[model samples]
Target chain A: MMIDHPLPPGSTIGILGGGQLGRMTSVAASRLGLKTHIYNDTPDAPAFDVAAAATVGAYDDLDAIARFAEQVDVVTCEFENVPAAALEAAGRSACVFPPVKSFEVAQDRLTEKDFVSGLGIAVAPYAAVATLADLKGAILRVPPPALLKTRRFGYDGKGQASIHTLCEAESAWEIIGEAPAILEGMVAFEREVSVIAVRGQDGTMRFYDVVENVHRGGILDTSTVPANMAPRLAGEAQAIAGRIAEALGHVGVLTVEMFQTGGASPSLAVNEIAPRVHNSGHWTQDACLISQFENHVRAICGWPLGDVARHSDAVMTNLIGDDAGEWRQNAAEAGTALHLYGKAEARPGRKMGHITRISPKS
Target chain B: MMIDHPLPPGSTIGILGGGQLGRMTSVAASRLGLKTHIYNDTPDAPAFDVAAAATVGAYDDLDAIARFAEQVDVVTCEFENVPAAALEAAGRSACVFPPVKSFEVAQDRLTEKDFVSGLGIAVAPYAAVATLADLKGAILRVPPPALLKTRRFGYDGKGQASIHTLCEAESAWEIIGEAPAILEGMVAFEREVSVIAVRGQDGTMRFYDVVENVHRGGILDTSTVPANMAPRLAGEAQAIAGRIAEALGHVGVLTVEMFQTGGASPSLAVNEIAPRVHNSGHWTQDACLISQFENHVRAICGWPLGDVARHSDAVMTNLIGDDAGEWRQNAAEAGTALHLYGKAEARPGRKMGHITRISPKS
Candidate 1:
């Protein structure tokens, strides 16, 4: 789809969520002389501190969203969980990038898997589980050594349970609170990698170098570029990401996480797609000509994507919970770029900040 | 001098004199989880768009400045022309970097030259001119082929006139509004260069690579890194900047602009000193490991200075007047990073923004 016109410097961009991603996106927008108005349910949203304007209200509040949409030149979201009704209301009055279809596909695990599989992409075998009976039947096909995940509102490994055996299917259904769910057969993956890419309003697309991701207790702990994988595997990962962006008609940054199964060839499996900036791509902030945040803003504004080549090798480590207590030492280290989220609390498993260390590639 | 404590994340950074410098600086501060309160004389200040809080008042408003300082953990100014009384008032309530003494020396052309010369640094030969008679007498000592410039409030070739011969002394005095001025004998320089360096509260200092500057009608047109200069001359410039920062006990970024005189060795002559972040250092935002703005924030907060190394060769060109109209073309250019100040009007000679293009160093 072609954008009507490119946003000028002084236009205001309306962001649908006020988290760290929104906060960093606001900073990038300001650098381009664009203002941002952030909307989030929490009163103490971190992005509010840097945004030109902000509203503390629920995404489902149509009146509030309508007012925000009317005031901004374009609307985009930081997270995929933005309510479909809110996007519809905003879309009626403003340009909402990534469209509702992409969000709809990614909102449910089963729909996302079906969409990718329909595109001839390889996905772990999955079955929809709406009730205990559905779970009982799904176990017969998907089998044990699988994951039963809630269909909606799941992140950072929450709202999911591992099914080690058929006997545990009932407990897994109970663990997910009897919510609509999906059962996916386990794949013996050697490692996880993700591709962060952006598509302009005019259909131009670009991708950053694939990054290898490491998680600790269901939360992202580290992301390193130069994933050290077979060139063919990396190329396949990027191709999958590009095809997904094109399929969704995406007009902003999107990330596709994949499983690299252990084998002589190391084939890749489609995991899940995020229709917004991803944590795994944070290293680009220090190593590339343009960061993912800037490219997102550029894409939504109908501008050309910036050069995404990395001139340095970088490792990004997330600071979770009390990890921020070592900020002093991190700040003292040379070549360390420390970025804090400005969150008031550092509860266990909470993402407080991140640090990226870079060195020029030889 | 040692700071009692380093300002932690979420601390407020009070910036005086809101402009493009303040806007960019606030963005950098936000990236570190710091909030900024901007003070400027106009409500339409570009920096106000991104600042967390803002005060519209003159620098002479001691009450407002005092209140701003009381609310922030540290105070810094974007320009040296900030009233001494305002800084004195703010310093009473908060930590002000690059202490007022440095401003006193750099605010006036005569005092700046004398201070640098006192450190055994070579400066342009000069004589003070307070009146027409003073100008006539200064001609005898400074000789012809000189420049008569105001000792204060002079920037970008404003408030200055060239004295080609002794007969033009009366006209030169009239041209300068009979203000206190300095007559300096011109040096036959092959090129101009500037050194951007920072000094922390604990007295640690570091310098970025030297940049060669080109002027169009006395305004900065372009700054290129890896200045094609003799290594001895570059080293001398860095040394001079370091010594000046040490002598003034500066606690933030400062720039020393010098003339690379034509000769077999091409020795340097100190032309001027700025006690705050300089426009010539803008390239550092993209070329160096850490930007000058971030370093300034780090210095004032008593944090360790970041590495000041460049991994790429960069050329920064200022977009003045209607040059911003070509922003789309600039944004589409590979390797070019575009920045636009949210200025509503692009009057003649006004700096709308700048673009920096970089290439990986071989």
Candidate 2:
């Protein structure tokens, strides 16, 4: 999206979704003297505690979206799952950063894969499936040991099913709620990693280090910096992230999840791109000079993006549910960085907080 | 002046100044999921923008301090210049972190020097001046080219006068409003450094690296991390800071500014201690795993202290006066961290914002 220079402070940042991400974005924006308006479907969200303005309404609440978009100078989303209709609503009045292209590429798994591959980017072997017959055919094309993912709105292992063989095909497709889906042959990956890149309206792009992520039951559990991998593989992950960001003329933080096929000839492949700041990029707030949230704010507001520089090699661990009990121990770590999401309940698997350890040198 | 088991979060943080510092303290408190009430004399201060509550009355207003103190869980100050009387009043009602000891130490230069020396800590040579006769006598002991600073409520280079000889004594004293003051010999130092440390209510302490700071006209201009000093001297500096915090029973982040007297075999001498998060520690917001402000909130509010561990080696430059004009440049330096203190004007020497850079290890 095209943006003019210097969207001054005091301008309201129209934030879509009222989760912890929105809460943090609001905090960041407030620190810079900017106002933030949070619009979300849920009313009892944690983000509401600190936000100055909030509209407790659904994404499809056009009237509210119109008023919100009109009131703010720029629009941004906390999560990528924001419906295209909602994004279009915000985009109609204020410039939606990351652009509609970002959402379009990210909303559908097949489309994202096609977009990445079309950019001459490497993706795991995949094929599209609209029917159960198509799923069976896709399995024949790839292998019995493959996965089926719904084209839209899948996160943290939801909306996807693994098929060990054709016997599980129909049930798997049925489990996905019969949405448009993609079948993908898995890569022999040693680790999962993500790159958080920020691009500006002026075509300036910056990439943070490739952070290796570990998932527990499809939920992000930890993200460690330095990727503790070969320099070449790390560089390749960052390069692919940069390429993907530039290809879409992406603005704000673009988080690309990739698999590092750690082998004799170590390599990496793109998994998916999160159009906004993702959970994986949370470490940058404590580990890097420029936090992913600040960069997102800078990019969306038409301000020059700050440096994507790493100060300390770091590790970020998520505190889900009962893990929050360790807040005391984590906070006492002298150098371990702790960030609580301000969530009140430690519901099972709910992200309550995180801790980061930044080691400047070996 | 002893404290045990850290005060917990959801407690209150009492701030003294209602300006940007209080504003920021409130912001940090809110981020850590704590409540903050800024106890300043101004109703229209910048801090009002973010605090849960603000007391707009005189610092010497005992009724106001009592009432304010009665409402909070724990008390902390935003600026060090909070009158001793106000601290006494507040402490009568609430558990004031840092105690009244730090206030006594900060209010009088002579007391500070004597206190540091009494603790077997190093300090610049100095003497007290209760009268013009005392000024002459003090200078005779310390020699020519000394500094005469008012014993109380002096800040922003005010309440200070430089004395070269006995001939300049009366005018120098008068320049400081003829208030009770002290005459100190010059500190012939190679560099100025500060240790920003957090002491929990439980007595647990954490320290950031020794920061080399530069001052322009008595106001901090820049602070560079890994201050390029010997680790031994840094350790000495940290030790001195820890002693000071322990001595005061300080809880929350306090900064001990010191002079590095020599280059080789360098020695550190106490200059002053800010009982709250100091401007020099602002870099912690980006350079460390936990920011001093957040840690300060955690400390005073009974939350556990976070790691004072820095994520990267860094440099922080204050955007004094019109220097904020270069914010765009700073913002554009990929990974350059920017923090604008919501001050509207760009007056000469005013701290409007700051930029920090955290360098990754090669």
Candidate 3:
């Protein structure tokens, strides 16, 4: 499944998930004359509306996954939670970007912390807990004012509980369904930021400007480019992301979320990593010459990466639930680009759309 | 079939052609959470690769066109050559943009010339030639050094012949297959330029910067925004396009191509009009907040028009036939955005792709 040359314009890239990320990636692929085939279990997946072809089958269905892979020249994923067996099945038929090793580390919270720390990177103190006795030991080592989170299948503040005192460890574990978990000592920080980096098959790397993120109710609320941080600190954040990509032998787009601690001297600590296109990089769609989704397609297809420079400073706001109801107002506003995902329902906490407002750099 | 309200997300737009314009429009529709169903006579049409659904039927198939229109909330065409009967069939089932009146005026060369002149717009002097006697009479009125072109199905410099002398009139007429034609006296123009204008259902209008175009072998080679002209003349060009749009009661995007006659006082003569998204506006995809394709979707859907302001100056070069072979080199160049149409072959004179380079506005 090793591709020695770039895939031609008509080749198809098979995608593992069918959400907003997949939908945007499909549009990017079309711009480059490439075709996309989406594989998702849901019948009405948003990505299905734009992809050249689609397969509605379970991720673990090895036969179906292999067939989907066989039809495409290469394979990539929109999310990291895709099962290892499915990726393995796809690998037998087509080359997969960001390799399975990266996904393996990103899928498990404990493994990701260990991987980042192993590279001599900054990470909050953490300990693994599989039972009540292990939780007690972890609380003693990691201390209170910590978070008890499931090792896998957690997103958007889900599958997590707060332990403010040692006495709350048992209840916090029960709240997470007593799953295999990790206790992380929360870092008191001033701001949260993310670095979006892309690596080509040739090992050439490009990093977008550090993006400052604000979260409400644990979901991304807004992402602004040219983060309000010193240039030296931004460089360090990008360097850390570069080291992670190099260590994992990652190809395509990878995102690193970090916490910035404020004091007399500021510093950054690795929070987590996502092995695919991320929500925090959505502002690039309107502000930069090449978007993260387009770069992902170029990287996976073995094409040269494009310019990462921004033409204007931008702020991207997410549309959650009823927030999408204000699309008319957003559309009427000048200099605003509104993007709505074709979801039938705007259930509470669901991401329905996003809008980006750009202005000349100050 | 009149749509008084904006179509909601997840609504379908039926497109009548599946060429590059339709392909790009479909991608734009997807960005707004809208789905597209493409109808083309060919099975492997470029647009079908990205649409939610597709129907392969002839334009003359009234029943098929009606059925296709019935499945969508609105209907639009990518090319003006679509049969009037086909649009009529679609209009019976759904609201069609750029209305049939505009298409009727655009489809016939003689009709378009008379319509423009009737509206007090400058156009090349022209006479209809339906018979050999008409050509003899037209030669006296229109004079030599004129173009005798077919009234229908003429594009990209096709179906045209030049008459440089009085004796050449009959041969020129025979060269165009003796179809109903028009003989337009040639004007000594210094440059070719175009204006892309969009009109909304609410009678709002927005105009993009005038673009200077270069043609090679009768097909567009490049389009540069901020056309090299006096500010007053550019404004005049826009005003002329606005008058035409108003006269036709047009909705959606319309393009008016003009010839700039060089002299102490440079004046514009209307060359022709396209009642749809056009090639000259492609630069907006990278240089402006909203592209012509996106704005066309908004106008046809009864939504507010977007800002037409550009953040950068751009030069767009087309990749025709063998020119696409330089894609690797183009990809390596910084500050360039390359777009390919997903066509399998690179036939001579075929538009395979385009590349645009942008820089901060001067």
Candidate 4:
């Protein structure tokens, strides 16, 4: 795509979706002198408040999408799960980044796992289960204490369950609403780690320092950069991210989640990949001079990619539900960087905001 | 003073008059999830490209101002020289941060001096001059080598001339188009410094670590944090800013330019106050985790102030005109942070961008 779109400052960047990710992306894009147009199905979408233009219409609404795409210079989605049809529709006249392949792999756990495994990368022991009987057999092979996850549209503990015993088998399958699934032998890992790497349109790749991620109930809880990984391991993780990005011809930041086991544990298995920018990279906003959000904007804008150097050793903690309600306390705490998502309701288990702290790394 | 216009994330921040200050402010507001509407008289206004909605209309166009403000939730201006009527027009219905009082002071140097004086602060010995005779008389009463500056709408070595010798009077008067002016005794100063402070709507004020500033050709060239002042002196400087903010009831970041002079060097004396956010605070974006831009957003939105604590001793260097053309060298320089304002041309003397490098104080 020869994007000579003449996207100067004040131009609107039409974004598909209005979650916190989109909300934050809009924030970064706006900082670069670009206006943002958020298109999402929900009227109450969080990003609506901060955007220049917004279309509260379903992704499938042709008229709405056409008008939405017409309002901005280029279009990008906050989440990778934007339907293929919706992307094709908005991508007609607007330049969409991360390409359609991002959603293709991102939308399905099976395809994503295969894509990772196909790259000669490490992933949890996994098998595709297209039917109930196939799932049972795969479980029999993989054994109990395996994860049965829907192949499509699963996140934050939704559309998935652990098969701890046979009594929970049918119910676990039913909990996922009988969707197509991927069964995997769960890896007992010491810690979850994620590497967020950016690939510019010109084929240059840069990675933020590795972030050791902490999650609770499947949702990201915290991420500390300059993650306690050996330099070689961090380099290896970055290389894995780069390979995936280059393989997908990916533009913008790609975050790959992995499980580290071994030594004291079993070690090193790929968990999943988020083709777009990830929450795990949020610490970049405060810890690195150029944040992941800003780098994503720069990469997508056809500008020279920025340095991803970390400014300080940092820790990022997500403020979930009532945790976000403690912003006053968090804000007053010295050296802590508080970022509130501006969400009205602090619903239980919902991500409301996060805090990043920079401390001496002695 | 009530802001009935409660714009959330997706709305536009209508900026009246786009300049470098507007451009930076637009960048800051966007990072907090607000899209911008940069309305400047010229098409090439620095802030326009980064905004979503822009109107190219003369400052006096009330209809255009109304239309622009109607489309945005809040209206903020970069230049205070905007005709009071023009500002009043834009701020008629929309929320305007810092309001007209701040703009009024910035337009006239004499009034600004008096305003600061009324706040029990120090300003240089000053006198107003509506004519050349008044200018001559004011100068005789003040120091032999005093500065004669246009009372309204002067900046950056423009709209005013240096008066070194008595013979330069007619030319100085003519060069400024014989505008209403002010004459002040030039204070012998050890250093030029500024305090960038933000006052929240709730009456709290937050000041960044006082910055030591260096200017070349009347343009800000470098700013270093921990301005190396005695801790008490730094506290005194911040107190001055707080008093000014409280007096103006200012609701955004205000950059107070001051002269540090006296005894071998007298310490600091107030020079001028910028009603809007200032360039001197640019280092806050990278050195301080919460940034001046975010603070501006918080102050204007009636949100709580953020931590302005510096993580490291920080240095900011301006990329003026062709200076910004050295993007490659700056980008390649390790540990030196680069920031490009996305300006297309690097015209001579034009401020294009800046760089910041934060090092710990030994």
Q: Deviation in angstroms for B70 in model 1?
A: 1.3
Residues B1-362 of candidate 3: C-alpha lDDT, one tens digit per residue: 55788998889999999999999999999888899999999998889988999999999999999999999999999999999899999999899997999999999999999999999999988999999889989999998899999999999889999999889977887899999999999988889999999999887899999999998888999999989999999999999999999999999999999999968789999999999998899999999989999999999998889889998899999999989988888887899999999998999999998999999887
lDDT of 1 by residue, A251-351 (tens): 89999999998677688898899999999999988888789999999999998789898878899999999999888898888888999988878999898
User: DockQ for the candidate 2 complex?
Assistant: 0.40
Residue-by-residue lDDT tens digits, candidate 2, A128-233: 9999999999999989678899998898899989999889998999999999999999777889999888888888788888888999998999898878788777
| CAPRI band for model 3 | high
Per-candidate RMSD, Å: 1.3, 3.6, 1.2, 4.2
Q: How well does candidate 1 score on lDDT at residue B134?
A: 88
**Which is the leading candidate under lDDT?**
3
Which lDDT tens digits does candidate 3 get at residues A42-112? 99899998889999999999999999999999999999999999999999989998799999999999999
TM-score of each: 0.98, 0.88, 0.98, 0.86
Ranking by DockQ: 3, 1, 2, 4
lDDT measured at residue A39 in model 4 versus the true structure, 0 to 100: 91
TM-score-wise, the better of 2 and 4 is 2
What DockQ does each prediction reach against the true complex?
0.72, 0.40, 0.82, 0.25
Evaluated at residue A104, the lDDT of candidate 3 is 100
